[model samples]
Target chain A: MSYKAIQLIKRPSGDLTPDIFATVELPRPVLEEGQFLVRQTHMSLDPAMRTWLQEREDSYIEPVQVGEVMRSYGVGEVVESRNPDYPAGARVIGITGWAEYVLGNADMQVVDPAIDPEALLSVFYMTGLTAYVGLIRIGRPKAGETLVVSGAAGSVGSLVGQIAKAEGMRVVGIAGSDEKCRWLEEELGFDKAINYKSDNLGGQLDEACPNGIDLYYENTGGVIQPLVFERMNRFGRIVVCGMISEYNRDQPTPGPSWVDINLKALRVEGFVVVDHQDKAQEATEALAGYLQNGQLRFRTQVLEGLDSAIDGLSMLFRGDNTGKLLVRI
Target chain B: MSYKAIQLIKRPSGDLTPDIFATVELPRPVLEEGQFLVRQTHMSLDPAMRTWLQEREDSYIEPVQVGEVMRSYGVGEVVESRNPDYPAGARVIGITGWAEYVLGNADMQVVDPAIDPEALLSVFYMTGLTAYVGLIRIGRPKAGETLVVSGAAGSVGSLVGQIAKAEGMRVVGIAGSDEKCRWLEEELGFDKAINYKSDNLGGQLDEACPNGIDLYYENTGGVIQPLVFERMNRFGRIVVCGMISEYNRDQPTPGPSWVDINLKALRVEGFVVVDHQDKAQEATEALAGYLQNGQLRFRTQVLEGLDSAIDGLSMLFRGDNTGKLLVRI
Candidate 1:
């Protein structure tokens, strides 16, 4: 039997195109002793994937080496198992390379879809946790405090705003489109939604949060970042999750200088979800409760077939997606 | 009797010169109810004073207008008082402008030099308290951890190194000269010292801190900042006390386009000593004990004569002195 896979043939000079990824067929990976073979189901398409495509080093994960299958956290079903640790019918979540099938050690977790169907919280093992750890652990929002989340309609950003609100803090979302902003405010119950592309962020922030922001969840860093910093209250906490705005630009991103951070006495921190693996189970439990209770809602712009994975990933850099972009295989 | 004061004749256009201030004679201020008249004894010369003179919109304290006395924190002796709370002949510290005599509210603390004596800890009210709050409240260094302190031999920076050592952490100091570096390593018990002016910081940091830095006490910002960020350990904390490097620049400071802060998963926080006033007594007692036990030492670069206030303040921007720079009357 043969399997199809996406491989990074050459490092891209700047933007990722068709030439960078090669669709090829190979003999299905064979399972060795203490290993299970999984047929890929859904691959997570994240903005961070764009960072990996570039040859530069990021904070948490390493860049994808040429000739190697693109690195991604995927969900798959066990098709064959040489190890008794996983059964044939089990669904697992693990660090699997971007491919039609993954063969690896039985270290992956076999999930109970009954407990979390569609692996909504499991896929979160990456995006959900990124939001969870960045906000709860790093930002540390207190109840009744105002939390301003930029890119609040995207995967991690949406979850961040909702989770903060669930914790009894006021949540305001900033997005690019009117539709995304409306959905975030009406459906997600965000206290305010400011479309960054159309609105004067500084003015909107002042109007939305009259008192001033106590916690800032930054996902898109650029001009808006400086404005948010200017409006932060004394002793405000900031969690720098991503800079989706500058991801695609060939030139350098221009962010407001950090002078305000010093004078205003703000706490600005940057973190990757992978570093908080120790608290993954706990975060999953708490986030899952929100999902199960209907207090939290997640939207995935599903692109069917593995062929669209590249486009889905690109959309994140372009600020095109309304929620989590998932590639269904 | 009347005394001369250095008044803010004009807001500075970047670099401060002698022409920005004008000498003016005024009648001695009279004490009102709940207020005291203090005869200025010593004035603190800090780089932060530069920000106050720029007429900046982002400044926490209002910029001094034309014909106003230069704002500063000075130690003064109360010669007359109407408030029952504080009596005459008391030494107090507060936001008393740069004048020979000041009329201030009784809300400011009266420092009893007879009780505490002039020791290393006496400066704890300002410089030393800044170090304590930045380290304990912000950096949160643990035992066996390594701390890197920039501006390492200056007032607050020097105390931060010694305090980190007392907490059982390895301390590294970064200063402008070999003399200051020697003072940090030899006299202050710092594990290592890197003179940013001479040595290759990256290579030197590798040799000095083999395990990497866990806590960074950032007193200087500009070229030295990225170097420190590059070597920080995962989850490292940086307490930004001041950025003296950009204090005197005539142009807007250009920060690194790509801040590796995200990749390092570091925390950079800014704090003011005045905001941590709630812990003043606690920090004072602890620091005083260490000084009395001969475990802590402090240095002061006393620029003689009140007439030398302008020259003393200028030394901070030029990096001409070490420890706390003070103007004695």
Candidate 2:
């Protein structure tokens, strides 16, 4: 059997265009001992994808080289296996690259959804884990404290605000669109939402969080950060999950003078979720509980077909998507 | 008896002129029960004194009001006593206004000379405690880590760099003059010293601390800070002790950008020495041990008489003093 996949054919200059990626066909590898093949079901299209696409010097996790299969994390089902770790029929989650079928060693640990069928997608692994670690673990939101999450309506930031609200914190989200802002406050129970594009960001933020922000889950870093830094209270902590705002810019745009950081005494830490692998299971379990209890809700903007990965990723850079965008294969 | 005293007649505008302070005569304070009179011996002149002189809308502490006897920390010997806590002829170190004599409560703590005589003037209380707490307790310098101290030849910065070097970490010092920088490297055993006035600060910093700054003792703010922030390693801790460079400036100068903090992920905290009073005795004793063992040395530039207090303090603002500035009355 042969599998179709999207591969990186060219590196991008400023923004990712359709010509940057090329789709190709290849014969599927035969499963060896302790090896399995998986048919990709759902692949995450995150703002971080845009960062990886850039062939520049940044804090990105290495750029996608030309002629290589595009890298991604996906949920897939095992189609064939000659391994003891996974059977021929099982659902698994791992770094299944941008392809319809994936061949990997069975030793790559995966969660079997057979035992607990109701383990929702939000709890499956990465999505929920990113939310859990980014909030309770990194942000350390305390009850009655104010939490301002940028990109608040997106996958990681959305769950971050919801979890902060659950912790009894006053959650304020900043999204690009008025609709996303409304959804955050009205549906997600965020205390308030400020549309970063239309609203007076600094003024609205001050009004929304009168006590000053305690924890800032920073997913967007650019002009918004200076505004947030100015109003931060003493001992405020910022967790840098991603900086989607600076991904597509052509020139090196310097961030504004936030000298208020030293004046206010703030702790800003940058973290990647993959570094916290030890707590992956615990994070997934807790987030799943929230999902089952209907305490948390997220929207998945599903883009059909594996070929749409590039366009789906571009949605993040353009700030078009309202939630966790997934390319359904 | 009457004693001559200097009162803060007015807050100085841009510079400290003679009119800013007024010499006054006050009836010597009577020794009540549990109180003693001490003839002032030495007064410590600090940059914090000038900071207290400025009027701030949101002042951290109340500014020294007009017509008030200036507050200072001094060493004196009790001449008369009516209290059991302190006997006549005992040496004490405590808060004493800028006066020839002071009548203080018997509750005033006695300085233990034998514990370590170096501490009585150098290591026991303010400057010593500032260095001890700011370097050990606050900055938390580790072995093999690079520690950078701005204003390195000054009172607190000098001790911090020396202490960091003693802890097996490489130490770099940034002082105002070539003479001071040379003294820091030669007399204090600092690994590297750069004259902020003569050398390119950013270039010198990069060359001196090639591994990058892990712990920064931030004393000089404004232009120096942005340069320091750029070279700081990830998870670097910055202990904001004082901003002497910007303290005397009349206008509100802009500080470093939040991008410097956001990208590097630094922890910047400002701490008052009084807040860490609980550990003062322990830190003082340890620092005294190092002094007695010839592991630590404190340099002082002493000017004689109460009238020289203003001049001694002026040396701090001008960055003329190489070590702790003291007024020997």
Candidate 3:
């Protein structure tokens, strides 16, 4: 059988586009022992996928090579299975590609059918777990403390703000648009939301966080980082989850302002969820409980087909999506 | 009842100079209800004194006014006492000024008489405790790990290297001079010493630390900072104690490349020794044991008169001090 798949034609410079990615017809693999055939259902579009496309081997994951199937994580439905564990009709997720179908072994991670599939694919699996681990495990935010979250309208930042708020912290968010800022404050229960694109971002942030920022959940890392870095309290903690602001730049982006970190004796740490698979279930249960109790809210923006995956991922860099941007194959 | 003192005549721009300070004769302070007179014997000179000179109100300690006695830590001999805790003939230490005499109460912390006075002034009081707390408490470095210390020839850096070496970590020292580097390697038992003034610092560091740096004791934050910052191993820890290189600058002098901090997932923390005085005796005894056992080596550059205090402090910002810079009253 033949299926269509997206192949990377050339290494990208700033942003991934349709030109660098070409659709190619490939023969479907014949299943072996403990293998299953999965028809692609949903493809996850994330900022980290941008890191995977870099032509460097030193990154957390190996860079995608020219003419290779675009490396991605996705959810699929098992159509045929040789193993009882992954019987036909079961849903699975893993490093599934931007393709119509996948023929793989038990290495296909099973997705729990109990949770909402949209939330599971977008937040609970990776982005939501990243927020949980970074905010609770690493940042260790305290009650009544002030928390400032960057990219507050995006997937990870939105969850991080709600989590901090649920923990009794006074939560403030920084987002790109006034509408996103309004959603963060009004819908997500953020104490305050500052528009990063505004001219008076520094002043608005200073007024919002009067006691100084105790915890900073950093997502977008170029312009807002220095402003928040200066306002951090003595012994503040920073969770460096993403830097979408500088992901497109060819050169190494300078910093998140080390002077404040050193001067205030602050703690700055970056984490990748791929390294912490052990906490996936724990974070999912905690997040699910919050979701069921109506204490947490998540938004997903689904784009149709694998053809839009390249452009969907670019939307993350430009702050185009209001929520978790995904592709429904 | 008269004594001479170093007085600040004007706020300094770059390096402090003798003209900005004038030695003036003044009447000795009279004892209060719970006060005793202390003949200041030794005044401590540290990189932090430069911070006190800043004309700002937001620092850890209150800034010294333009016409006040230079704020410093000093050791004194109790000449007249009104309290048994600080009896006559006893040696005491505290935040005494750059004066020949100090009238103090029980707040005048008494230093143990035996642990070499120079060592007491330099290490036991602030610098040594800073090194111990930062390396052991904050860095939490494990044995068999690699440690790279900046300003390895200076007071705190010297202690940090010996302490890391004692804990079985491979120690690499970075200093400004060949002579200082040799002393760190030959006298202090550092495994490697890289002169930061060398033409190829990155190449030298790469060769010396094949395992990559696991812990960095950052005392000098200038050009060498970014170089070492890039070579940090994953989950590396940086103990930010002082930034002597930028102490003389009128404006913020850029940064030490923070992109490396996030990329490597490093933990960078700065500390004030005064904040950790509770760990003083513990660190002092641990340090003294090493000193008595000949496991550690210390040096003190004693400036002869109070008049040389400006030049001595200036020497620190210029990286001219080869050891613990001090002033003898």
Candidate 4:
């Protein structure tokens, strides 16, 4: 039997190109004892993937090596299992790759098959966990405090704004387009939304956050970063989640001056969701509770197949996707 | 009786000029029912004084208003008092101004007359507390960790390097002059000292911090900031104490990008000493313990009289002072 997988042939210079990834057909691996083979149904294409593609020595996770299947997170079904823990016909989710059939490791968790794969990948997985950890765990939002989230129309950012709203914070989202801004404000219950592409972003941000920003969830690192940073209140907490805007650039722009940071006593912190895996149970429960209460909402931009992931991943950097960018295998 | 005081006649445009301050004679304050008179003895000229002169509304404390006495922290002796709490001949340390004599506030703490005023200002007061809160409290240095301190010859930075060294961490100091670098290495016992003015700062930093920087005490924000920031290891902590180099510039330079911050999961926090006053007692005891153990050492460059403070304050911005700059009143 054979399966299809996309292998990283070359590293991107500045922007991703189709020639960098090659689709290949490989023979299915024979499952060893205590191991299983998973048929990946859906794979998430995230902004962090860009960093994984780079040849950085100090990244939190090891960079995906050349000639290897690109690393990703996804939901799948165990079709052939040699382990009792993950029997055949069981649904699981964890670290997967850009392949239709992948050999599952011990880290994959068996989940209920009845849950929608879109909802599973969008809400109950790394996406939701990232939003919860960055906004609730790191930002420490307080009732009535103002929160400004960049990339607000994206998966983690959209969830972050909603969670802040549920916590009684005045949530202001900054996104790429007016359509996405409307979706954030009207559909997701954000207090306000500003299109970063609009003129006078500083004035718009000031109008949106009249009390000044108290908790800033940073996703995109661009002009909006300095604009929001300058408006931060004393002792404001900045949760640096991702810098999608700067990932493709050869030289990222410098951030705001540290003088205000010292003068205002601000705390700027960055965290990766993998480091907080211990909080997964609590995060899942809280996120599920929010979902049950109708406080959490999400949208998915699904691609057709595995080969589409190469181009689909670039949608995140270009801000072309309105919600979670995923590829259905 | 009349005494001499320096008043802030105008705000500085960028670099502090002598004409901004005016020396004049003023009548000494009469002791009220609960108030006492303080005979200022040794006033500390700090880098933060430059910030207090700015007309910034978002500052942690109120700016020193034009036509008012320049704000400072100094050691004084209680010459006369109506309040029994502060009796005659009690030496105290607290917030004072650029004057020969002034009314003491209730916040002033009485210190033992036997302790040197330089030791009090350099180790036990705001300087020591700042170093403690930033390094011990915020940075949370672990043994065998590598620390890089900018402005390593300044009051707070010097103490920070020593404290980290006492905690069994390798400390690297960054200063402007080679002499300051030698003093930090030979006298203060720093593991390595890099002259920021020398060519190939990046090469020197890479050589100094072979293990990569884990704890960064930021006192002077300039070229050294970006160089050290790029060398930060995973989960590094940056303590933004002061930006002396940027204080005098009309437009302070922007900091490094947050891309690495997210990738490395670093924490960059800024704090003002006044905000952490609740930790004063514990800090004083710890600092005193270090002092008695010979782990802490400090030097003071004392100016002659009150009028000299107008120009002495500029020494901090120019990196001209070797250690804690003070004025003997």
DockQ scores of all models, one per candidate: 0.49, 0.32, 0.49, 0.89
Candidate structures ordered by TM-score, highest first: 4, 3, 1, 2
Better of 2 and 3 by lDDT: 3
What docking class should model 2 receive? acceptable
- Residue B261 alpha-carbon offset, candidate 3, angstroms: 3.1
lDDT of 3 by residue, B71-121 (tens): 888888999887778889888988888888877755678766875678787
Best by TM-score, which number?
Answer: 4
Clashes of 2: 3
lDDT of 2 by residue, B1-329 (tens): 79988899888877677778888889987666677898888888877788778776434557788988888888888889887677787888887878889888533678754443224656568888888888888788899999988888888888888888888999998888889988988988999998777657888888888898899898777567778877888668888888777766665465544433444455566666755679977997788678777878778888877888766677888888868888888
Model 4 per-residue lDDT at A130: 96
Candidate 4 chain A, which ten residues in sequence have the lowest lDDT sum?
A52-61
Residue B278 lDDT in model 2?
91
Candidate 4 docking quality: incorrect, acceptable, medium or high: high
Q: How would you class the docking of model 1?
A: medium
Candidate 3: stretches off by over 4 Å: A105-107, B256-258
Worst 10 residues of 4 chain B by lDDT: B50-59
> Which model scores highest in DockQ?
4
**lDDT at residue B86 of model 3 (Cα atoms):** 86
Candidate 4 lDDT over residue span B155-243, tens digit each:
99999999999999999999989999999999999999999989999999999999999999999998899999999999999999999
Clashing pairs in 4: none
- Interface RMSD for all numbered candidates: 2.7, 4.2, 2.4, 0.6
Better of 3 and 4 by DockQ: 4
Chain A TM-scores for all candidates read 0.94, 0.92, 0.96, 0.99
